[model samples]
Target: MSFKNLLLLCSIIWLGVSCKSEKEDPGPSGPGVPASFGFNSLKVNGAYSGFKYNDVNLKPKVRFTFSAPINNATVANGVTFQSASGEKIAFTSVQEGGDSSVVITPSADLKYLTSYSVTATKALKSKAGGMLLNEVKVELITALDATDKFPVISDEALLTLVQRQTFKYFWDFAHPVSGLARERDSSGDVVTSGGSGFGIMTIPIAIERKFITRAQGLERMQKIVSFLKKAQTFHGAFPHWLNGATGVVVPFSDKDNGADLVETSFLVQGLLTVRQYFNEGNAAETALRADINAIWEAVEWDWFRKNNENVLYWHWSPNFGWDMNHQIRGWNECLVTYALAASSPTHSIDKTVYDNGWAGNSTFRNGNEYYGTTLPLGEPLGGPLFFSHYSFLGLNPTGLTDRFANYFTQNKAHTLINYNYCKANPQQYYGYSDQCWGLTASDIPNGYNANSPSNDKGVITPTAALSAFPYTPTESMKALKFFYYKLGDKLWGEYGFRDAFSLDQLWFADTYLAIDQGPIVVMIENYRSGLPWKLCMSSPEVKTGLKKLGFTSPAL
Candidate 1:
């Protein structure tokens, strides 16, 4: 047979397609050779054997084909899989047809990034009760193949692997001009304030994980801060976007051209943590803190209050002031807006602005129960899962409590509600399961939309569940495995897990969003080391803000 055809045949055999090569033709034996006595191995021999197969699946299916019908009783004694380390692997052998090839599947995940061999001994007998004349083996190595598979690693190792890869979005692909994260993989010069804010939080995570040297991360931070210093602002508040190349306004909408207090607040959330993080006595750290302070203190949080009314506005344009007129409402992803506005050392807002403006809305409080989990705040089913992620990335909800809700309780309940709903899967989506869920804003087959229980689309956003690592470790880890080991070929890529995927529609988004990607790195770090939380919370101003808002932090 041609080498190409031989390789194709080997692949078919591995997939459990029954085969009897033309060379061995089970139909009849040579004049002197018995059809049931001599047989070649199902796996491709020498050419592919000397070099370890890099595409071997961790949970491999090995097939053993024969020239003639096999003696079922002797199959078990004849076929075995063994690790190079002398470990005997357990597997189940199946023969779909009485005389077909035997397909062996390991009972558990194999040690990835390592070599192993599958062997069929000569003791095996055929239907004619004659011993097989040759022994056959297949050698392989389990290597990561993002196109269709992933490696199996320890939970801690997986967490580290995930954190490091996610950091690549904020690092390798960050906008060249501003050194800030792009809105998405496709976004070029249009840089987002909110997404950049989330990206800032990942700097420390990358540093702590050793993905980048501290000096390298510090250099990036310097570039980010320098760009922000020159970026256009209205009343000291940054717009929702800035042209990365010129530090000019890139209006989110025609009316949203000037100041975006909510986005600025999100930006400040990361700034404060960074200000707290690089507290070493080094001159560079000292200068970074000073630059961060200049940006932080300059934001007129109270200016967004629109003549000091007790609530914060979302946007204000020099061209169309307050035309957007969106309020920074809560029980949403804007809690950090209020938290940082209240925390600002120079342009701080009164707590009443938070209470009357953010929590004052009718939808601000939801004591309702969904999927047996009572939500302290938010729309039924807890709105899109990001409501718990964005703000809390730096807010540290572990022991944070306020009049409206116990921040930790609220966030965890929100995650669980989202989790249980996906588990119940009343929508009956193709891939909904306990280990495969996470709904939030992402690219859908039709376009982008906020996915939640209320708006149950048959889509799963990896960041939703994976970012909830701190709130729902067990549940999140299960989803992590499902993404990494099962759907990894389609979901994981250059920037870690891609934006979103829909199995029923056979649609997988090959994009990454800064807001979504940042949380995966920061939250996973928070889950493992509490680095971001501890750094953000260490700021005296953050503690002051939480306290003024009538919240008590046991950790504080």
Candidate 2:
């Protein structure tokens, strides 16, 4: 029991504590300490979870972040990607990111919907000459292959899948703050009024298909209704865009900072549909019905008539009232505005407004022939396919007729004319086949334009054909097969189909818009079961409005 014995015992205890601390710490204790040299994190295609890349033609990349600065020379030899079959993938280059990360780019485009693995070998060394303790690997799965042979599917199943997936844009990827649909994929924090209306119409479809639970759907509907109750409004009409978080008006254009009658009509269409769907006896359902009713009743539709004029104006800004004085007219997508105006219980418009303003002061009639098919309404070649789609979404077109024309025949003719126009290939666009023809207002490589034969730009919007399913099921089925089976990887995405594509320009969009995505679901549901149309028509207000407008339908 000497002093030397005590000092030796103390030294042994200190060594034991030091070793335990070093072993427990996952990270390096100091710069010179030997540490695990492999990646602390790995990102395949920039995500930990498997992601469906939008562009099938683009090569996939792998990135790794190491615990310590990696040796520059070891990166090329230590990192590699291989297919599931164990074949090595050729890399075009390996580039360093700062001192701690490396990115591997593939030599060619990765196969679509295929699984691949990225590996970092133990040979990967830190700048301090320490080798990785173990090899690390991760998996990445590409999205569906568009060029694969077509698979057999029932028409009913295909339509249901399309509707459900499109509904996800509004339900799953809704704006975080407002619980509303975004104006488009790239539009941050900007929620759309009309597009959200289209989205709202699809909620029942989602619930019926079990894409979402009824409770989930109702919760989201509550969020949307609450936001609407607090959001800025002009004469009870919402603007085209709003800040998703604040519910404040987001100016669509320089002067379009106030009421939008057409957009409001679109919103009300969905709201009324929701009101019809949730008219149950449950307390939550009752509350939802009342909220929707309040929103529907508050819209001052008569105020948009511009001081008792026989026309309803499209927009009215508080800062510049009536400066952007575009009138709502027909043979276009604004027919719903007139119908809703007449249908409004609290603020209804007279039938004369429909006769004068919507019918283009009696110049709305257009009976024309294109490609051996007679278009019963609108200008030549039917003036884009959306005219048939937007209004007819909730307003059942089957056996729907007015003094103007038989809507079913008119819409069918319009879709057929658009299809035949592409089949004829008058412009000789690259991919204009019977199964690949739909021209509408959508994004183009140069910019956005409404595509038609008369105003023909080669941009083909998938929503155009898909939304026309009710009017032209046989032709629409052909287009659906082409879009889903042939061009799916390029055209479709997580939520649904991208905004538009141009085969002539060899361009494809990697975005989705609320306006385009909403109709695909609501109209497809309409085509499949006539659910949305039937529900909207069930409303007493809608029946009264149609009767006042002198319109007749089988449902009516």
Candidate 3:
């Protein structure tokens, strides 16, 4: 069985502290009023028949009050939460010596989509030594917490479930030996440098969310950093792909068999944010931080400039040096490339490189309006939604500014345009709605394509909308509900929402991509809690680079 299934199975063991049913507090206007109720049994919610099948998350805490004070000592033997088959479900109870109410929480989360009964027998005693006349019971069914089923999982529950499941793509499915994230679910040993970086960013969230223990996260991180220390690099930059088990280069294409500077920057972005998160100065975390710093300081950002040119080149091949000759520039996902480039402590690029290469000197800038939204940069309709995502995953875009733009403003405009285009449905796709919209690079029926207003593929990637939670909450939440509640049976899966779906062709992906999955977890959290943004922006290196590149922000 998978590790996730094993954890679920562990929750069913019979070691629960045991708890019972509940009752509502009998009362009058204030004090000095006599309470009217026969203390026959626990008056659970004021009705003895039993509660309607109330729904909650698996490990819900059920609280009930009584007409009189509860006998704390008698609770353990007097109450029991059990399954239909009479299997006793263990729980821990909380009540003070004279407290009128008791709260019970399952020792472990209850089975997803299962039913259980909380019963209080006449054996329950009141603090005044009064006994119950009969038994009382309450019924509850767990919320649909698994992908195999469906229920009205909305709001915070939906957000939490999405984060947990999408996180599994990195934690549960990561490469076994190297702990690296693969390019796609089926990529096997071909781990990706950029996506692995994204995966690294998610680990601290997993730890904070209690998805994994701190030691587990540390172990996984240690494995990844250790592998990168030994992995093949061109001038201290990791290649786009590497053999997870052997730390060898795996060419993207023949000419691309070398260090991919853009990908390396992405990897470094995740690493730097994570390094800040583990700043408690403990031995393990300290070692990890030092190792990450070594990797960060060693990148030859200046050398990637192709003989001191203003532009940063994307690839550097040991055997085919500068053969790819790809320059990192403007209004795309590579802004992170330049940000990290300028942020490097050792071999740092000049601020002029960013100005002359990424902006100011570049002509890709477009200030035109599309779909009633004016984009500050990138292709019309803001290229793919990922251009808004990739850089800002760690780098806080909100309130961030350079001479060029206020990043949050730029990103928000970009997202609305993408969202509006899908709503426009120029090509008339099947599932384009206010509640079902998002487009970006994802698997299309005909292969992979970057779906956007300009490159329409009738495909919708959940990440495109879901990751924009911080930029557009109401719309993103609508898209999330539509993906999980409406199209969930096919759209949701073991790892999370499947990679992408295209209803126009009656197609849906059963795949997950590292680059796509990471942002969903990080950005949703960036919306709920600015953890990544806070950590990334706090990096002195990032601050130095942003300042050198003529940026300013409250965070700075």
Candidate 4:
């Protein structure tokens, strides 16, 4: 069927048919060691497919012992338990089991009743040689309870809701994933065809693990699987906006005449995000993966592959439209990020994608060229230039990590501190004009600055740009906390999160679309938590790509 499904089958085959046994001496402990008489198991008894069942439940316990003497020669110092996902599980009780064993219960409820594969270990230091340790694993199946209620929305549910919205906003045929209602102008037209209202699919999957349970997040992912199988293009590049009514590629010329690599990168991130859940024979994750693989195979990097002099060109309008074949920093940023993320060191992509025509000095400008570039006074780069923001600091998948990290970290911290301070003295900052205030921040106080367009002094949001912070978490978290918690009133909105920081300017559109929030939610989640990237690394396509890149570790 789908490549993702095929990969899932392969993973199952790999796990079931083969047993990989390492030869290194087992230390003080290893795999399985329950705290109680018998080990515990956690599995979804009735879950046959992705989000197929209503709910699941299970009981878990640990097995251990404590009868030995005070002589430090024999028994293990203590026992420790951990879940497969790396979270610690506390043992409930340590009572005597019959004559030789002991029983132990868990301190908290198991994360979710789906299927928890656990490992317990016992440690003992030895004076004679190396320390001694023992461990064991347990898999238990939990039954589905039709009467069990679904969870209510809470602050903790924000991540999960964003994820579901990511899938729902894009794939309308399945369960209704939630998100900000699509934004609209007074005339009722969507702001930018591909800008504010476009639904950003697959993004939530990339980052939902930061705040929600895996089962809760993926329950919404199945719709994305079904949606992507149906969305395709002949040349391979996914479009900037899928038609709101029919699910086909919506015709839009302002951006790449419809096929934009920047948008495609966001889609690619989403596809990779859901990949991890396909294991255990889940159909949806696998199906979606195959479509994504095909899409990746069909992408034409040739459009951006130019080198008129030595400088690289970014966006390409198939019809020679605006910014056609022009070199722009904004485009380069996302392009490099995607290429590096998808590249294999050994199987390097054809050099053509990086050799396209370069733009004139006037056309190809950056912050350095701001003084000469034709634009509003002190309004360098004008509107929300997606490419420049991600590229300038080297934050993309393939750019200079050190430089990008510095740029993002500094900017993010500055934004947080600004908002933190702004909260106290809103009157001083709020009244100033965007450009005046924006310029003042850089010219006078100098530290944190505002996003462009002057309208968003710091308040009006940049849906796409702000979301890129996931690539740099330490910085992203600072911005998010400031916007949501510190600058609470203006920033956070109802349908989904707003476009940018409120102090700059804030607007909440009625309908939620994929393009704006999808990448933001997914990437931010990944930054706060690494689940999405982890899942992508688990895929065969990524695994093969990494191996080709000369990596010894298994794919992500």
Of models 2 and 4, which has the larger TM-score?
A: 2
The candidate with the higher TM-score, 1 or 3, is 1
Query: lDDT values of the candidates?
Result: 0.82, 0.82, 0.82, 0.38
Which residue pairs overlap in candidate 3's backbone? 16-90, 20-79, 23-65, 40-132, 40-133
Candidate 3 colliding pairs, count? 5
Q: For residues 1-556, could you state the per-residue lDDT of candidate 3 as single tens digits?
A: 6343455345323111112222243323345444322222232333332343433567766665555677888888878889766889998888743577777778987875456888766667777665653455667665444352477855998898999999998988999999999899999899999998888999888888889998998889899999889988888999999999999999999989998988898899999988998887789999999999999988999999998999999888888888877788888888888888888888888888988888854456778999898888777678899999998998898889988888999999999998888887776655587887888999988699988887887789999999999999999998998788767877898889988987654567988999999999999999998999999999998999888888999988
**Residue 97, candidate 4: C-alpha displacement in angstroms:** 94
lDDT of 4: 0.38
| lDDT tens digits by residue: candidate 1, 278-369 | 88999999999999999988888888888888988888888887878788888799888888888888888888888898899998899988
Of candidate 3, the 10-residue stretch with the lowest lDDT total is 14-23
Model 1 residue 286 CA deviation (Å) reads: 1.0
Stretches of candidate 3 exceeding 4 Å from the true structure: 1-149
Off by over 4 Å in 1: 1-148
Query: Which of the two candidates, 1 or 4, achieves a greater lDDT against the reference?
Result: 1
lDDT of 4 by residue, 384-405 (tens): 4333333222122321222112
